[model samples]
Target: MRVAACLMTLCIPAVSLLAAGCPDTGASYDDFAARYDKINPGTTVASGPSQCETPLGSDMEATGNWLFTLSVKLNPKKAFVLSAAVTAEMQDDGSMLVDMSLQPLSATDQTTPVCGATIEFTDLPVAPDGSFAWVLAPNETPLSLCGEANPISMSEILTGLQIAGTICGPADAPFACGTVTGIVEAPLPDFDLTGSSFTMQKALTDGSFPPPVLNCERAPADF
Candidate 1:
């Protein structure tokens, strides 16, 4: 009886964690992005001339946003040791454009070209709650590394390599997809560096999975 009770006790917590689902999941991709403004990396609730701002383009508004830290993995095995921050603003045309900044939960010196700056996701439609659904589109310009045609995408900056995946909407959004959840056939090359293609340290695939847990306990207290 004692042994059986111990086994059952151990199993309960494991089952609880599994049943809990993701804690910081976005209602939509747009919802999670507010996390960035919460962290106040750049934009703030400043008033008058100096209000909510961004490093992307021009200042779109004065109302600041929130920053939610979520976990992500790369390739099939490698998880993002650091958490990434997402922030966004709506363009005049009603389309939403986002700015992703990678904050390697480790790495004290802060490296160059954080993973967030790699892809330029635009034309996403923001819902009433400010959450967005995004889809990747093909670019005429092929992305290359070392003069080799990587064939992924052309950056909005019209520069070097970028990666794109084929999700029409948020696969892990809090809401349900009523219909039209079909996958695209024969998709283009992705940024899966873990596979044959060269990696640029971005999300391996576009599907939203649960955020990863911290690999180390010694990580910064702020993290």
Candidate 2:
């Protein structure tokens, strides 16, 4: 009986630990979606100013009117990393166009081109509550500004953005998986443009899932 009791004591703690690691999935999507909507209101896009030629390196100076935002969530006190790439276009009608995509760099052990740094998971995680923000910079690279045909600088500048969320326990844990949420804002410059525009989308997909287009714009300046 004493031996049986000892075994039970060990099993009890193990079971409790297992329970603590499991996360709840009911509020997962809704929580993340709400945060996304808050940051990226559909009507933030608008028209602004025109582009002036820079004197130094013949660079075009342009600004944006709207802000972009993105949020994510993870569980089990594990690491979650993100990388994104954006593409812009000048519409024939004179509006600005943009495209954006995000990829998980360290969460699932995937490799990508934009994985600049790995976000380490901490006991005091920021997911589900805090977010990281960065601004969408001007197309510093030749490829960003001129597309595939023109290759200018090696570095690109992104502007006005934040990524925030929580890293909770595992899926099966009682503490529940933490959520990561935030926004990425990219404003546009103005011009006497008609149809010139751009689209912004996220590059990362869940695991091996197919890539998805998060946002798009044909006439950002018209918004």
Candidate 3:
């Protein structure tokens, strides 16, 4: 599993959300991953170039790319912009699904060390209005997405606004990657949120900074 470990102390107000029950109670997280495999089929990402092929935002306006100015405050002094090329499809069950392969982009204009690292979020549901949340796998099976011991769990509180609609927060959800230090128990709501009516300009969450430069061409071919 490729992991992007974010070390930050985030304290989001936890709030309860209504449940979106699973179709089967016996199903496991593995079951969900299998469903995702059916959707994405098979894929392998080739290592990306040391430098991105182009400045990140140049092609954002082009069709098929989803350019979003995000609200992510890493701290009172620093924040990060969120941008990615999104692919969505209708699942057999009628739920709309999405995939976004993550790359490290620089908001500071100065190149950041995270250029070629990869973090992929696969098969999340997409709402009609574009708001979406990862409701987590069923409680019956406790295994990390990477097949390790389950590191964290999502609560109804997290399923509320914190997990909703592309806001970069997941109150109680740790990443699919195994244990991320300092965040093993309660990973920094550390998600790169997505989905908002295709807006390119939005309020700067922490300060003025460009979104990280992404290499969408390097995104996994199957995704």
Backbone clashes under 3 angstroms, per model: 12, 92, 5
Cα lDDT tens digits, model 3, 174-210, are 0110000011112334332222111222223343333
User: So what's the TM-score on candidate 1?
Assistant: 0.24
Model 1 residue 62 lDDT score: 11
Cα miss at 131, model 2 (Å)? 8.4
Off by over 4 Å in 1: 1-75, 106-161, 166-210, 213-223
Give lDDT for model 1.
Answer: 0.23
Report the number of backbone clashes for model 2: 92
Model 2: lDDT of residue 217: 15
**All candidates: CA RMSD (Å):** 20.6, 22.6, 17.0
Q: Quick one: ranking by TM-score, best first?
A: 3, 1, 2
lDDT of 3 at 109: 34
TM-score of every prediction relative to native: 0.24, 0.20, 0.33
Q: Give per-residue lDDT, candidate 1, residue 84.
A: 31
Candidate 2 residue lDDT tens string, 18-96: 1122122223323434444555454111101111121111101111111222211111122122343333343443332
Per lDDT, the best of the predicted structures is 3
lDDT over C-alpha atoms for residue 74 of model 1: 27
Ranked by lDDT from best down, the candidates are 3, 1, 2
